[model samples]
Target chain A: MADTDSSQRVQEILTQATEELKSIKVPNDDQLEYDLGNLLVSNNNTLDETLTRDPEKIDSYLHNLARDSIQALLNRVWELPSERIDSDIYATLPKPTTRLPREKPVPKPRPPTKWEKYAREKGINNRKKDKKVWDDVLKRWVPRFGYRKIAAEKEKNWVKEVPSNADPFEDQFAKAAEMKKENVAKNEFQRLRNIAKNKKIKVPSVGVTGNEYASKNELSMAMHHAKHATASRGKFQPELPNEKKVKGLGKKRKIEFTTGSGQVEKKRNIEVLEKMDKPSLNLDGAIHKEIRDENVAMDLKRKGGKVYGRRSKMGGRHRTKSDHKSLKLGTGFQGKGKGKGKGKGKPKGKPNVGAKKKIGGPKMQGKGRPAGKGKMKGKGKGK
Target chain B: MRPLKNEETVLVFTKLKKYIGSNVRALLERSDGLYCFRLHNGRIYYVKEDIMKFAATLPRDNIVSLGVCFGKITKGGKFLLHITALDFLHPYCQNKIWIKESAEQNFMYGNHVYKSGLSRISENTPKYAGVVVLSSKDIPLGFGVAAKATAECRHADPMDIICFHQADIGEYVRNEEALI
Candidate 1:
C-alpha cells in the first residue's frame, strides 16, 4: 500500500514538471535536443518513460533532479570533519624539505684574473702594444695587424730613396733658372718694343754701332723732338720774345744810342713819286648815268639774266610787304589769294585779315575773384 | 610568480629593492617630478639615471599587466624587459632572448617610446624603432621593443618565457611554487 502511494506521488510530480517545461521556451533549436538528452541521461530511470516522448516534460524533470542531487552531495561532503580529511591527504603526500642540492657550488665561479677584473671595471679589454702603429698615409695612429695595414705600409714607403749625388736635379734646376731669366728679359724687350711702336717711334736696331754715344744722344734728341712735335702739331702760336726793356733812362743815353750806328749820313740818289692824272667828275650826267647802270643790272638779274651775283637764281633779301608787291612789268605775280589776277594792291601792315588779336585788356585781364573767398562780392571782383 | 602589485610606484620601488639590493632606500621620492632610489649602504649603490628614465617611461597602470625583469647580460650590459616584451621577437631572434639583437632592440625601443613620450611602445623596427645599447665590443646588451610587440603577445611578460620555458626549469624554478 505504501509503494502505491509513492508511485502516485511521483506521477503527480512528473505531471507538474511537464507543465513547467511546456511553459519555458527553448533558447536554441540546435542544442535543445542535446540539452534535453543530457538531462535525461543524468536522471536515467528516475523519470517516467512517457516523459521521453515529450522533451519539454523531460527537461523540467531533469532540472529539478539535478538541483536536488547537487544539494544532497554538497551536504554530505560538508558534514565530513575538515581536520580529518586534511590529515588523510597530508599522510599520502611527499615529505617537505628545507634545503635543496648545493647545485655543485656553481662550479665555484673562478675568481676573476687581474686582467679580467680590469676588463670588467673598464668594460673592455686593453689593446696589445704591437697592434698600434702610426699610419703615415692616413695621418693617424691605427692598429698595425689589421686589413688596412699592408696598404698603409705600401703608401708609407711608396717613395724610393735616391742617392743625392746620382741625381742631376741641380743641373736641371740651374738650366731652368737660366731659361726663366732669358724668358723674362725677352718679355721685357718685347714690351718696350711694343711701347715704342705704339708711340710711332722707330725701334733701334738690335746690334752694336760704332757711334754708340753719338747715336744714343741723337736718339734722345730725336725722341724729344718727336714728343715736342706731337705735342704742338695742331697748335698755331709763337713764343713771346724774352728781351728786357730798360725803364726811365736819360735822353742823352737815348740820343747816344741812336747816333752810334743808326744815323749815318751817306748820300745817295733820291727816288721821285709818279702820279697818273685824269678828269674829275662831270656831276649831273655822271650821277644819272651811274644810277641808270645799277638799275639796269638789278633788273637784268631779276629777269633771270646771267649776272655776277645771280649764281643762285632764287637769291633775294627776305620779302617785306613792299618787296612782295613790287610787280615786274613782263612777269606774272601770282600772289597768295584765290585768284590768278593781282589782289587788291597787296594789303598793308601784315595784311591783318586772319591775324590773332592781341590778348591784353578787359576780358582776359580781370582777376575773377580773390582766393578763399566766394565767387561774388570779393575785393578784386570784376576789376 | 607572485602577482605584482598594481601600483606603479610600489612596483618600481619593489623592483629597485629586489634587483639593486634590499639595503637600498628611496633617496628622492616624488612621483610628480623625478624619483630617485638609493642603496642605504655606505657605497650608496643606487639605481642609475637610465633605470629611472626607463621607469618613468612605463605606462602608469599597465606596467604590472606585463612582468618585467632586469639583470646584467654580461659584465657591463644591463637589461630590462617585460616578460612578454620579446615573446613575438624571440622567434625572429632565433629563440634566444638574451642574445645581442634582442637585448639591443628591447633597450632601443624602450628609449624610443620614452623619447616619444608615448605610454605605448611602437611595433615595427628599422622605421619607427629605437636604438639598442651595445657593449664596447659591439655586443648587444639590451633592446627596447615597441610596446606593440608586448601587446601582440596579449600583453604577456616577455621574461615569463625565460621563467616558464621547459629548458629553464632547473635554472629558474627554485621550487614548485615557482612553477605556479
Candidate 2:
C-alpha cells in the first residue's frame, strides 16, 4: 500500500510535466547547451525518496540522470558527436528541396511577327489595345423568350399584396407551416422510436426520458447536430422538394379557380350534370326544379350572370355594368326566343326564293370560262 | 558541423537567447566554429537549418514565436528536439521515472511502457505532466507521456498501458526513432 501510494505520486508528476513540455520552444544554441547541462543535473532530483534518502547522493544522482536524459535528447534531435565536429552541416540539415543548376540557362528571344515588323517599319505603336465591342449588346446578342418572367408577372398579379418589411413566415399560419417542416425529420425519428418502443425493439435509449429506443444512426446523427438549433444566421432555406419535381400539380389546383380554364370546365360539368339521371335543381331559376348537386350548384352560382339585378363577381364577374360583355371574338350573346325566320336555330335552314342557278349572271360557266393551264396536259413536247 | 562565424550568428543567437534562456547566450559567447553537440553516445544531426528557419519566423520586434513550434517552410521535416527544447524549461521535468529492466526492452522497441513496469516514480509528479524515462540501471530511456498523475497511477492497476508514447528510444546506437 505504501509502495503504491509513492508510485501514484510519481505518475502524476510525469504526466503533468510531459503535457506542459510537449508544446514547442524554438530558441537554441547556448540555451540548448545550458539546458543540456541543467538537464544532466536535475533529472533524478525531483523524487521525494531520493531527496530524503541521502542528501549527498541526491545531487549526484540528479546530475547523472540529467546528463543521460540530455544525452538521449541530443542524440534524438541533433545527431551531434560528444566531442567531434562534422564538416557537412548541410547533410545534417534538411536538404534543400530543389536541385541547383550548374549554370543559369539563357532564354532565347522570339522572332518578330509580320505585324510587329510592319509596325516597327511604319513607325507606328503596336502596344495600345484595340477597341472592343464586347460590351455592346448589338454584337454577340442572344434572344431570350422570357417565358418564366411573363409567368412570374402573372403570378405577382395573383398575390395582389406582399408585405415588404415583414417576413411571410412571421405570421402565425406561416410560422406553423415552417415549424412543421423543421420538426418533420425529428418527428419522423421519434415516430420510429415510439413504434420500436411499443414493439419492444431491443435498443437502449441514451438520451431524453422514456423507454424510446435509440438506434446507432440516430445517436450518431444527434451527435453531429445540436438539438433544436435555429437557422438564425441567414435566410432560412426550407427543405422543400423542388418545384420542377411537382410540375403540373398547381394546374390541377387552378382548375376550379375562375382563371383561364373555368368557363370550359363549367360547360363540361353542366353537360355531365345534364346526363345524370337523378336531376338536380337549377339555382338559376329554370322551370325544371330538382335536388341540386353541389358542384352543379356552384357552377350555376358562377354562371348566374345577374344576381338580384346586380352583377355578381362569381366567375365571369363584371366590376362595373359596362364591362359585362364576353371578351372572346367568336360568339355574341343571344336572347331566348323561338325564331321562325332568321333569329335562331340555324335560321330554319332557309331557302332563298329568287335564287336561280348562278351560271351566266356574274358567275362563270364552263362555256364562257377558259380552262386553267395544266403543266402535264401534254400540249407541249414531252420531256 | 562546421562552426558558423560569430558575426553571422550573433543576431540569431541573441534572438534565440531571449527565448530558451541565458545559458544559451553564454554558450554562444564561448563558441568556436569547430565541434557540434554529441547526443546519446554520438550521432551526426541533420535539419539544423530548421532551427535557423524557426528563429527567422519570429518577429524582429518581439519574440512572438518563442514557445511555438512551426513546421518547416516546406513540410516533411518535423523533429522531436523542437518540442523537447521547451520541455527543457518545463518545471515538472525535475522528476524521472525509471522503467523496470524487462520494460526497458519493450520501451527500446518503440512500444509504450506500461505503468506496471514503472520501477521508480517521483512523489511530486502531477497529472498529465511530461517526464524523462530511464532504465532501472539509471540510463535515460527517452521522453514519455504519463497517463495520469503519479499519485493516481500508484492506486490504479499495474496492467494499464499508462505511459503514452512520445519519443523513440536510442542509447548505445541510433535507431529509426532517432531519425526525427
Candidate 3:
C-alpha cells in the first residue's frame, strides 16, 4: 500500500509540473530548441536527460525550456542598456594642412631699343643701292647740278682742247667739197624742173622773181613740122624733090534715108539741125527710130521672150498682134495656174482651209454631246 | 513566455543532460507556437502549430496519411517512456528524433500506423508510462536535439519524454544501408 502511494505522488507531481509549464508562454520555441540542441550536441551532452524524464514529456518540456531560456536571455540583454559614445571623439580625427606657397612670378620681356630701329632703317636704305647703280649704267645722265651750268662747262672744255696739229687746210678743203655738193644738187633740181616744164609746165625755185614768162609759139611750130616730116618719111611714100605736088583727097560720102511714105530724103547731121535757123523733123524721126530699136532689142532678151539668130527680128518694131496676145495670156496666168506647161502642180490656196475644215466638220458633230463627254469620247475613239 | 537566452538554453539542454542521463529529449518552443523536437541522437526537429496541436504540429493536408505509435525503452538505468512513430510531424521533428527511418519510410518495427498500425497513446500507471510520438519525412537530411519543460519546449506544453527519434530515413537509406 505505501509503494502505491509513492507512485501516486509521483504521478501527481508530474501532472502539476505539466500544468505549470502550460501556464508559461513559449515564444519561438522551435528555433530556440534547434539552437539549444545544436549547443548541447556541440558540448557533448545528451539531449534526452536534459529534456524530460519520459519520452511523453519530451516535446512539451523542450518547447517550454526553450521559451524560458530565450526570454531570460532577452531580459538580461535588455536590462543592460547599450553604452553611449563621447561626442568629442570626432575632434581626434586628423586635419588637412594648407597648400604649398605660390610659385615665383615669371619676369616680363623688355621692348626694343632706339638703336635697333635706326639700324633697321639704314639696312633698308642700303638695299636701294642696286636701283641707283642700274640708273647710272643706262647713261641717261641728267646732271646732278643745273643743266645750263653743265652745258657751259662742256663748251669751255671743247674750246680748251683744240689742238695745234689739226690742219686749217684740211678744214678749207672740207668746206670746198661741201659747197661743190650743194652746187651739184641745185643743178640736178633745176634740170628736173625743166623736164617737167616741157611735159606741161612748172616754175623753178632757183631765184624768187615777181615776173613769169610764157612759152614761145616758134618752138612749138618747129616741133610740129619735124614730127610731120618724120611721119611722112615713115609712111614709105616717094618725096617730091623740092617741088609742090597736089594729090587728090578721098571724096566724103553722103547717106540718104527713106520715109515711111516712100519719099527718099538726104540725111542731115543731128548737130547741124540743132544749129539751124529752123527745126527739122528728119533728125527727130531718126532719134525716135534708134530709141524704139533699142527698146525692142531689150524686150526680146527679157525672161521667156523668143531669141533670134544674131539680131532680134522684132528690133525697132512696135508690139505686133501676136506679141500683145502673148503678153495678155502671160498676165492672165500671173495669179492663176499655168497648168502643166511649167511641169509644176496646181497652185496652193489659203493655208487656213485645213484648219477650218477640222474645226467646222467634226466640231459641229462634237457639239451634239456634252463638251466633256464628246472630247473624251473623241480621244477614246481615235485609231 | 519570455525570450530564451543562449546560456539558459545551454544549461537546460546541454549542461543539465550531463547531470541527469543521456536519454532525455530536449527542445525549444518558438514564440509563434511552433514545436521543435530534440532527440537523444543529437538531432533538432520542428513541427508547425497548425498541423496537430494536441500531438505534433504539421500541415493539415499531410494529416491524410498521419500515423502515431507510443512505447517504452529503458536505457542507461533510466526507464524511458518513448514515442516510436508519428508520421504527421514535420521533417524537422523527424530529424530531431534521430531515427534511422523517417515517417514516410517504413516504420521502425515494420509497423505502419497510417495504413494498418498500432495506437501511439500510452497509460501513466506505475510500471507503465505515456509517450508522445511525432515524426515526418518532410526533412530529407541531417539531425537535431533539444530539452523539454524549459522555455525552449516545443510541440507540447509540458514535454513527457526523455528521448525521441528524429531522422530523415531517406538519408539513412542512401548512406548507411543499401536496398535489397
Please report the candidate that would top TM-score against the real structure.
2
Assess the local accuracy of residue B177 in candidate 2 as a C-alpha lDDT between 0 and 100.
43
- Native-to-model Cα distance after best TM-score fit, residue B42 in candidate 3, in Å: 17
Give the distance in Å from residue A181's predicted Cα in candidate 1 to where it truly belongs: 89
Which runs in model 2 stand beyond 4 Å of their true positions?
Answer: A1-102, A107-383, B1-95, B170-180
Complex DockQ per candidate: 0.01, 0.01, 0.00
- The A-chain TM-scores of all the candidates are 0.13, 0.12, 0.12
Global lDDT scores for all candidate models: 0.35, 0.43, 0.34
Q: Which has the higher lDDT value, candidate number 1 or candidate number 2?
A: 2
* lDDT of each residue in A1-383, candidate 3, tens digit only: 99999999999999999987644343433343222211221112346784577878898877755566666444333444353221111111122233435555775554333444577877744333322222243345434455454564454444333247766445544555699799999778656655565565544322342123534443333333344466564265554466333232248643221111111100121122223324545888898777655544544432224644344465544443445665676632112111122223322221122323343333322223333332211111111
lDDT of 1 by residue, A30-88 (tens): 22111221122122334577875787888887676555554443333344444332012
Candidate 1, TM-score of its B chain: 0.18
Clash number by candidate, in order: 22, 42, 95
Model 1: how far residue A17 lies from native, Å: 20
